[model samples]
Target: MSASISVIIPIYNGEQDLPGLIETLRSQTYPASCVEYLLVDNNSRDRTAEMLIAASEEMATQGITLRPLTEANIQSSYAARNTGIRAANSEILVFTDADCRPQPDWLTLLIEPFAKENIGLVAGEVVALPSQNLLEKYADCKDVLSQKHTINHPFCAYGQTANLAVRRQAFEQVGLFRPYLTTGGDADMCWRILQGTDWEIEFVPRAIVRHRHRATLEELRSQWKRYGCSNRYLHELHGVDLQRELKGKESLRRLARWVLKELPINTLKVATGKGSAVELLQTPLDLFSFNARTIGQREAKLPEKAKEIDRL
Candidate 1:
């Protein structure tokens, strides 16, 4: 049978967590014969390579293949994924991280939306690990991970790389991912596709997976810094005037954030939303802070970020 999907998992030092991801896929409700698991290992110093070798041995017995592609100079997660896409054999390619475990029907649900010809990309949600720590709690509070992809938007394309599937033609047409970006690469892809094309993107809530989060406050700060840097890069790369647009995008969300923290809400005469009013109000503060953290060293942040990538 022709492969229905190529499950591309890119790794750096995924270690023991990688094994569970493969196991979860094996237990999927989707026929195991429908996909090939392609694991891309981008130069790990840890036992990631060794562990995958062991896992592949067991997979061999079950008539399944866990192929590995190792390379030098592991740049970033986005680069690893691009490698996987290049190596993929299936026309329908799915990308996920090794740290994430799919639900039994994750693959099946993700692919079902593609029954329509114009549906070029499919984006699913990322469920976070529930934890008691402040950082994890912060992420849980800020990122409404439980929110489903609203199908009403025909242009629905915001996707996290952890759980996304795209047709080979659309991916090729959209020009794949910008290798220059370390983060926000997935967002970049979505933006490029929507720039103007005869493409349709669908959101599939059933295509879900659990994502791992930073365990400590320091890691959380670093994550934010990287995020800020990505925001800066994306704004510039896309020719977006973030200074002008951010305040128009962030206020109410920030106020709601303050509300969640039990802090004081700044404004009164609150208006209900169908638009970006609240975000517009809050974005300036975020923009200033983002710029402060990003500093004049936005260029320097990339190499600095390159150093922090010990992807386990």
Candidate 2:
């Protein structure tokens, strides 16, 4: 039988988590013959290609086809995803990250909402995986990646690509994800789909995936910096002001106060067992994220600013 759904995952040095993800896919409740797995290797420098080759052989033995493709020219996950979308044969295109482990019913629930003719996109729920450290614990408590909060929000309302599904026709109409963006491309695509077409994006709480959060301070900082750069690019693309949104004297002052006074007091309370450690740790992380993003936004716009100066 032909596949009714195609699940696309983009990988770059994802060897650590690939095994579990493959196992999850193997055990999915959806019919194995009716699902096509497209794993795109975005020029991984590790054993990702080797692992996928082995996985393809194993999956084939179970009556499943795992197609491994390469997107070596570009280094962006969005570019890799676009490559997968173009190669997909199914009517429904589902997206998830390499580190995410979908529940057995994830595919079933993700595709169920498409039965409604007006629903063009489905944003599934993403819950943080079990935390192994303070940073991961803090991330879980903050639930920053949850799409439930994005529903009905005016300025931002979109599902993350880590657990999102889109109809093939609607996806093509929006022109797929922008290849240039290193981040925020998922939100950009959802926004274009909503604004450029008559279709609606629905949040399916039942379709769930367990995601692994940044396990260390360094990883967290790097993630936020990338997010910052991406936010700047997104603002430029949509004609919004990044400086006005992210950088201001008042914002800096508030961040300072939070870091110096409030964070210490909260940490003290947590140490004394009078407050939640997760909540307290989240404060500093938030400030760090803001500052990192501001720096990234400014850095990314340097070339553009130089051009403006030359023009003047």
Candidate 3:
């Protein structure tokens, strides 16, 4: 099989995660000769560039083309991904994050749907990596990074770029990701493809990427804040009205219920050793997520017309 697929991963200060990511790529069941790995460095300040160079040299003899590209002018991951998209030499492009570890068959299954010409996008499952940390456990319990929620979204089904694949032809037709978009670019891309062409999206649960959950409260807050920013972008760019957001008194009441009711019950359960720490942490995590997202949404501001569309 001629190089039919290119895996694009954007990294910034990813030295700690790159080795494991490279190992997982090396272990991919997909034939190395038929795929290229485009690792785009989004202006990392650490040893990420040197590490990528070392990885490229080491993996070269393995028939794996590990190409390292730099997106210095643009600091966004989306910008880095756009760079990879332009440099890719394949008809199909697969995307994942540096912090994720794909199962051995992840690549094989991820690109399998592209056999059908009409399949424009494929999203695999994202499962949290096992961790003893409280926040990580809470995230795992809540399925925070799972693609199921996005794939089943009411407004529009989409995929997270953490484990998504797209047909190059369809991708080009829809145009590249908003180069400067810091969040929600994946959803925007998928929506564009769906609206612009006759292409379809697929969800393959077997093609799993193990994502590291945020181990700290600060990390969790940051993640949700980005998600909130994404919500705003989607609304401004695509007119996706997120009705799920509770506002004003409703939001306060929801938080109060968690604190006044569920917290005590879960605390007692934990005290009795009948409930997992995961359950106890859920309430606080929810509160943190809500506040962070609210802040992000309030902070996110976009141009009046971020993307062009005819309202016909």
Candidate 4:
């Protein structure tokens, strides 16, 4: 039977997670036959591709299609994912990162919302995978507690990409995610869909996955920097007021709150060179300056393009 839905796993050196991920999907309540599990490997250096091949062979015995696609330097997961969608032979497209392992009911829970013809996409819950790592704890707290729900409206007032699934039809309408988006591709894609058309994104809490944030302090800081950089690009492309995403007054308030609640954490992070505790003081000043500069860049970009058009 042809696939009704395809699950796209965009991988990058994610060999570590393959065994658990493949096993979890196999364990899903959804028939292994109904969903084509597309393991799109973006040039993994480790055993990811090989592992997928082995898993495919094993799954083939059970009549499951564990399809694998290979490509290089699709440096962005956003690009890898769109490639997988194009390669998918299904009406619906579901996405989860290589690092997240879903519960057995994940696919069934996420796809059930599609019964409403009006629903464009569905987002599942991302729980924190049980880990001894502090980063995992932090990720779990932020992702699970801070999550929001949207049934048929803009869903990403607070967004993280670890647990998002979208319709293939929505891709044709909204266009694929930004290729240059390094980290906030999930937010960029959601915002793009919202800007172009009205599509309902159902947030199902029961359809959950565990996010495995296997990062040290250094990794966490690097990831945050990448996020900030990507946010700037996403907001610029979509013409969202950067000041709002940054939330100038709110950021200051948050900084104050952070100073109170996170000073000790900052001390550890700063001592380890993970972040700048001193820079934390400059946050309010930095927020204003950063907003000013981003606006300047936005304004400057317009004239440069206008000049090109004038010469043409």
Ranking by lDDT, best first? 3, 2, 1, 4
Regions more than 4 Å wrong, model 2 = 1-3, 241-272, 302-312
**Residue pairs clashing, model 4:** 152-200
Q: Residue pairs in steric clash, candidate 3? A: none
**CA RMSD, predictions in order:** 7.7, 5.1, 3.0, 7.7
Locate the minimum summed-lDDT window of 10 residues in model 3: 303-312
Better structure of 1 and 3 per lDDT: 3
* Winner of 1 and 3 under TM-score: 3
Off by over 4 Å in 4: 1-3, 143-146, 149-160, 243-312
Candidate that would win on lDDT: 3
Instruction: Give candidate 3 regions above 4 Å deviation.
Output: 1-3, 243-248, 251-260, 303-312
Evaluate residue 139 in candidate 2 and report its C-alpha lDDT on the 0 to 100 scale.
74
Per-model CA lDDT versus the true structure = 0.67, 0.82, 0.87, 0.67
Clash number by candidate, in order: 13, 0, 0, 1
Estimate, for each residue in 25-143, the C-alpha lDDT of model 3 and write its tens digit. Answer: 99998888888999999999999999999999999988889999999997788889988999999988999999999999998888888777778899999998888988888888888
Cα-based TM-score, every candidate: 0.75, 0.87, 0.93, 0.73
Clashing pairs in 2: none
What ranking emerges by TM-score with the best candidate at the front? Answer: 3, 2, 1, 4
What is candidate 1's TM-score against the reference? Answer: 0.75
lDDT of 2 by residue, 1-312 (tens): 433999999999999989999999998898988999999999999999999999999999999989998999878898899889989999899999999999999998888878889999999999988876888888777776687866654555788889999988887676878665677678778888888898888899989999888987888888877777766776776654564444567667877888888888988898899887676766557777777777777777523421110000
lDDT (tens digit, per residue) of candidate 4 on 56-86: 9999998889998875755667767777887
